[model samples]
Target: MTTKRREACPNLEANLEACNCSYEPCGRKGLCCQCVAYHRRAGQLPACFFTEAAEQTYDRSFDRFIQTWS
Candidate 1:
């Protein structure tokens, strides 16, 4: 896959401030676009969709997201 280099995002700082993903060392931590794309390809949702307590579970599944929100 010849992916283009990600441009420096303007919202990086803000995204980082709000991101709740508990998986440390994630390259996509503050990159919402990449994070969402990555999880979507894996048939999952990003941690931001869940509550703080729920995000800690690291499930990231659609069922988990729905269960957490609904």
Candidate 2:
């Protein structure tokens, strides 16, 4: 059996440098679709979840993601 690789979003490459979601051992980096899905399923958000200031705080919890977006 073999698994297929997910397609990479070109936009993610441009934003990886700014993304801070450090919880996952991922390769997608910061693309929205992948990031959102990954986080939503886990009840959390990607490193790009919060602003630079908020991200620096390292509060990647689900509650923090809502508070930041809300």
Candidate 3:
């Protein structure tokens, strides 16, 4: 399957307000598609899947996400 380059999300500014990622220097902070794709490629979920406390740990693993919820 081919992936198309996505346009910047229309809600980027609003998304940033709600983004809980604790990583200060992330390039993909407000770019949800890029953030999701980046993490998916690594078999993980983006920091948004995690709680603010969990996100700070920067573990991004799918297992960690589940453990956080469970």
Maximum-lDDT candidate: 1
Across 1-70, the per-residue lDDT of candidate 2 in tens digits comes to 1122223555555566666656455655556677678667877766775877677676668888788888
Which residue pairs collide, candidate 2? 20-47, 21-47
Instruction: Give the TM-score of each candidate.
Output: 0.83, 0.51, 0.83
Write the residue-wise lDDT of candidate 1 on 1-70 in tens digits: 0132235576777888899889987888778999999999999999999889999999999999888878
The Cα local distance difference test for each model comes to 0.84, 0.65, 0.83
Q: What TM-score would you give candidate 2 relative to the actual structure? A: 0.51
Ranking by lDDT: 1, 3, 2
Pairwise lDDT winner, candidates 2 and 3 = 3
lDDT of 2: 0.65
lDDT score at residue 39, model 3, on the 0-100 scale = 92
Q: What value does the lDDT take at residue 25 in candidate 1?
A: 76
On TM-score, the stronger of 1 and 2 is 1
**Per-residue accuracy of model 3 over 21-68 as CA lDDT, tens digit each:** 988888787888889999999999988888988999999998899999
